[model samples]
Target chain A: MRELTYREALREAMAEEMERDERVFLMGEEVGHYNGAYKVSEGLLDRFGERRVVDTPIAETGFAGVGIGAAMVGLRPIIEFMTWNFSLCAYDQLVNNAAKLRYMSGGQITLPIVFRGPGGAAHQLAAQHSQAVESLYAYVPGLKVIAPSTPADAKGLLKTAIRDENPVIFIEGEVLYGHKGPVQDEEYQIPLGRGEVKRTGQDVTIVAWSKMVHAALDAATELAKEGIELEVIDPRTLRPLDDRMIFDSVKKTNRCIIVEEGWPFAGLGAEIAYRIMKEGFDYLDAPVVRVTGEDVPMPYAKNLEHEVFPGVEKVVRAVRDVLYS
Target chain B: MDKTLMLSLYRDMIRIRRFEEEAARSYSRGKIGGFLHLYNGQEAVAVGAMSAVEPTDYIVATYRDHGHYLARVGDMNAAMAELFGKADGCAKGRGGSMHYFDVAKRFMGGHAIVGGHVPIAAGIAFASKYRGEPDVTLCFFGEGTANMGAFHEGLSLAALWKLPVIFICENNLYSMGTPLYRTLSVEDVAVRAKGYPMAQEIVNGDDVLEVREVIRHAAKRARTESLPILIEAKTYRFRGHSMSDPAKYRTKEEVKEWMERDPIRLLAERIYALGIANEEQLKAVDEAAKQEVAGAVRFADESPSPDTATLFDDIYYEPEHHEQDEKVVPLEKRRQQASV
Candidate 1:
């Protein structure tokens, strides 16, 4: 095993997949010659040639839909939107065509495509660029929404997403691109719809995903000093949620807290809380608490941005609230 | 053109007209549900263009797809059953009329959203080129779709990639009652292609022969160069935009004028004048098409609706290998297993 940064892992995944299949290609704004806005696709143009690693114009809806069509025709297309903010322009293509084509075509067409870009708050980026859409896309019927917190998970999951016969939304956090983790140098796939418990404990279950997973893990480490053992669970895939695993975790822990980096209204945390209440309510010792971003647009100021996003402190508070009150 | 080929186009157009008439009736009688976009007045465009396309070539069309469906596949019964929402339909009743698909015929779909199929058509063409297949993708949409942002993106990408796609625009004067002239600054839809550097042709959609000639040349160009082409078929829709439209936007006199230039009649006259078919033979073709429509209606009426038990099936590809590996570790016990 070797340590790889999230951006390096992403580039590795693209490089490996493109090498494995001639049909696998990268296309996005600045993905080819410019090496990606976030440098996730750096050096791919040199290795895979200009035809495969394509640099697209600033046209999200058109290129995104074209990727879907190409996928339908038997070429695997990895579409990179610069950020989740820009994906809004191509939302119709993502939701209407990419997600629904397989189902609407009665399963005749397989949309083996991945729409990837940075998601959620990246310090002081402000309202237009900082919204999280993991929960929004997960609510749709025909899509796989993935937001991995670790570098190893990002590489493995992206490889799987490119090979998947259905459409997958690969969400990356801008802040976590430089974070490093140990990844095996062998071919592998982490199956979608499985949860990984990062830290095990007995007092509470902290269900989180993406950046919140890291926050929850940090909160667990701090709570350990106080003798409050908190279990932190990361659901990499949101659409095909591991509900049974979640229910079982809640039943064991007896109390639960959900941490999310999105707004409280109709957020992923709300869904988690609802699921725990509906399925494992009798096993709960207290109400399931949610630690989530404030229900307001992220501000440009660093202090205000910190106030908007959930952190270790918020997760720790939520854990104590669920356990005691 | 060969006599057989000319008669085949005429027969397909007649079949589509009769099938759509039945579909419209079925829809009005509460047999079909959801949006029913009729291609009543735009038969010549589909008939003529589809005539030039190889059977293996791909075709993608908009929600107003009944005419395109018939012209492409010549499967009247399935089209009618689809409109009737029967389980035996082309999409197995899941797609209904607005989303008809025939994979074997390479007829991609009846896309609901305006200009939505443009990208898909490009994709199919890209795949064809990737696999070294000489087939082309004929993408059909109305003049109204030209004004959409998707149209610009789809066409631009198709041209930039040099994908073998023929973007067929049926300028039916209106996009569901919003007249094209009112919405688009450039009334001529073909003028939009000036920006893309792709081969473009404008033809009389009222004349099936002219459409045939334009598409034939475009198809040849696409097959040889792998270059995308745009064909703007100047046509009109005789009926209201949908089954529900009162058609208050246009006068009865205008409707009468378009009706006089009916695509089917134009093809019929051309065929008769060329001595391809006598009056008696043309009458037989009309009778046979009517019978085919009646049979399709009967098939749809006799077929059953989809069972609720399987409503969620085919929605996602079934996970073929669901048996978890016996060596998989549970989250709570993963550390213990690792230590062991």
Candidate 2:
């Protein structure tokens, strides 16, 4: 296993895929010439040339729909949004065109396209940039959503997404690009809709995803010091969620707390908690709890931003309440 | 210049006219639901423009799309069945009237959102250019789409990349009920293309020959040079925006004036003037269109509604193996798995 930063792993997956398939191309703002806004696509322009590694002007709706159209005609296109917040400009393209083309065409048109970008809060970027939109996309019936929290999952899942025959929404962590972790050197793909237990225990299950997975593991470590063993489940794929893994964890632990960076209402945490209580009702010892960001637009103040976020302390306190000890 | 080509174009325009007329009759009879966009006076734009391009070239159109489908595929049963929401329809009843698709024919889709299909049309052309294919893509939409962000972006990208897509704006002078005077800042739609700095042309959409000639030149540039061009087809929609629209906003005189230049009549007159078709021969074309539309209505009447058992199909492609056929789980599978 070779350790690589999340950004490097993603680049390797793309570079390898492009070398393997001529039909595959990367198109986005600053993805070329500028070596990617975050250097995620660094050195790709030189390797693939301008034809495959295209750089478009700042028009998300334009390029996003272009990618869908290309996919409709037997091309695999990866459309980057720079940031998920900017994806709102291309919402109609995503929701109307990409999400519904296959279903609307009655399967005559299959969009083998990926809409990937960084999401969730990063530092004090504040209200507009610091939002999580996985739930909004997950609620749509046709899209497959993935939010990989680690370098390995990021590479494996993105490789799988590029080769998938459906439109995929790949949400990369806004802050986890530089995080280093071990990834397999050989070609491999992790099947979507699968969850990984980063750290397992039996006292209580702490389910999370993306950046929250790191927080859940931190919470687990602190809880372990207090002799409150915790099971941390990271649902890499948000849509077609790996709920069976979460349910199996809950069936073992008999108690659960969902941690999320998104708002509490109608968020991924709410949906996961509802599923746990619905199917694993008999297995529950207490009500399923959710430790999520407060129900407000992200604030600018660093302290207020931290207060809005669900940190390790919130997860620890949520465990004690769910445990009633 | 072929007599058969001229007559076939004439016959195809009549077919779309008759097909939509029958669809309207069915809608009034409560056979069809949802939004029904009728292409009454704009038949020549589809027939004429489609005729100018090769069959292998891609085509994308707006929601008033039955004309484009008939001009491209012309399977009345699928077209009428789609309006009736039947399983045998082009999109297997999932798309209904607004989403007819024929990938085999390369008639990409019947997109409903205003200017949404413009960029998609460019993307199809993008693929052709990327693959070094000489194929061109024809994109048709209304004058109203010119005001949307997607329209500008699509045109801008096409010009920037020199994609082989011909953007034809059928400037029918109305955005639904809002006239161009009310919605557009500069009423000349072709002038907007100047900003994209692409080659452009304008044609009288009512005159099928003129529309055909203009598109022929544009398509040639697209195929040979991989360049995009914008064309404004000055036309009109005889009926209201959709089945629900009363069209009371327009004066009877305005509607009556545009009807005099009706696309179907203009082509019929041209056929007679050229002596390519006579009263009996042209009458026979209309007669055949009437019979075909009648049969389509019958087919739609006899077709079955899509089964509830497979409602979940086509949401996503779930392939069982690398070279294996993709499987679509039944719609109930999601609900079934959710309960567990």
Candidate 3:
């Protein structure tokens, strides 16, 4: 076992997969010569050569469709959107072409492609650049969505996404890129649709994913002093959720709190809360509450941005509300 | 072109013309639904260009794709059944008229969005070049598609990469009721290739031989040199954009004028002018094409609609990543919940 940042873990997984399979290639803006905007693809061009680690112009729709077309034949393409915010430029290719091609073609095409990049708010970058679009992607039927919290999970899930037989939307944590954790040296893959119980307890359940997972863990640390003993769950795969883990936890805790960074209205949190209500309705001692970003399009100022985003305090207050009510 | 090649091209144009005519009849009778874009006037471009390339070469077309499929795959039953919305269709009835796909034939399928498939076609060529394959990709769209960013991006990348993709813009005058003069910034779409530093050609689509020769050279250049090219096939549609429209935008004189240069008739005149075939033989070719289309109609009429029970199938190509014990709600339970 060795320590690696989330960025290094992703680079390792891609480099390893490229070594294993010749068909796997990376293509995106600044992925090659520039060593990636965030250095996520640092030194890949030197190692894999310009052919595999391709660099494209500032054209998302073009390159995205190119990846889809390549996938249609035999090549497996890793189409990187520099940031998930920039992905809106090529949303048509992802939503219409990539997602629907498999079904629209009546299962004739096997799309082995991954659309990966950093998502969610980062520092002072406001409005356009700050967005967690997992819900929008998850709503599409033909796509599998994955958002990993830990470096280990990021590496493992990314490897799985590359090898998967369909279109995968791999949303990496924007702020968690530099976060370090121990990763195994041996080859491994974390299966999609599986959730991990990051920390277990019986008093209340706090479910989260990606950046929000850290906030939930922090909230649990503070709540434990008050004998709350909050159980933390991270459903790594957003779409085909690890439902059994969430339901089992809810049944035990008898109270649930969903934590997410996306907009509160029609967000992934709404779906998770409704599912808890449906499946664990009888077991619940209190109502399932959601700790999510404010409904407004993220504001600019640091304090207002802080107020809009979900944090440890919000999760703690949500836990208290579910417990007290 | 030789006599055999000339006759085949003539016959191919008639095949598409008759198929579209019959499909239009079926639509009038309330058989097919959704968009039904007929390639009535643009027959020469598909038949002529598809003739120049190998079947292994890829073909990606826009929503008005019946002609491209007929020219490349030439499965009249499959194409007609696709329009009929039957399970026996090329895309298993999922794609409808707008999206006709035959992956096995390397006909990448029909895309509905005006310029959306351009990049997909470029990507197909990108894959071919990456794999060291000589197969080129022919991307088909209308003049109206030139306005889309996707089209420019597709061309720009293809040229920059020196990928083997030929963008064939069938400038059929009207882009869904709006004429090119209104929709396009420039009257000629081929010159736009200058932006990409790509080779360009403008062909009189009524002349099947010229189209065949242009694509032949373009495909050769693409295959050997891996160069992208933009080809504007100056053509027009005889019918409205789709089955729904009355085509009130154009004057009867204009429609009548373009119809006189119809590729089917133009090719027949060429055949007769070259003394390749007599009037009776050309008439026989037309009759045979009509009969072939009539048979396809009968086959489509007898085919079954897709089963509602299997509606949920093919949404994803399931991967063996996990033995989901409870990850997914069972279909039966989901159905029950939906009812509730």
Best by DockQ: 2
State which candidate has the highest TM-score.
Answer: 2
- What lDDT tens digits, residue by residue, belong to model 2 across residues A4-77? 99999999999999999999999999999999998999999999999999999999989998999999999999
RMSD of each: 4.9, 1.8, 2.6
Docking class of 3: medium
Which sequence of candidate numbers ranks them by DockQ, best first? Answer: 2, 3, 1
Count backbone clashes in candidate 1: 0
**Each model's TM-score?**
0.95, 0.98, 0.97
Q: Per-residue error at B317 for model 2, in Å?
A: 0.7
Off by over 4 Å in 1: B321-340
Candidate scoring better on TM-score of 2 and 3: 2
**Candidate 3, chain B, TM-score (2 decimals):** 0.94
Off by over 4 Å in 3: B319-340
Ranking by lDDT: 2, 3, 1
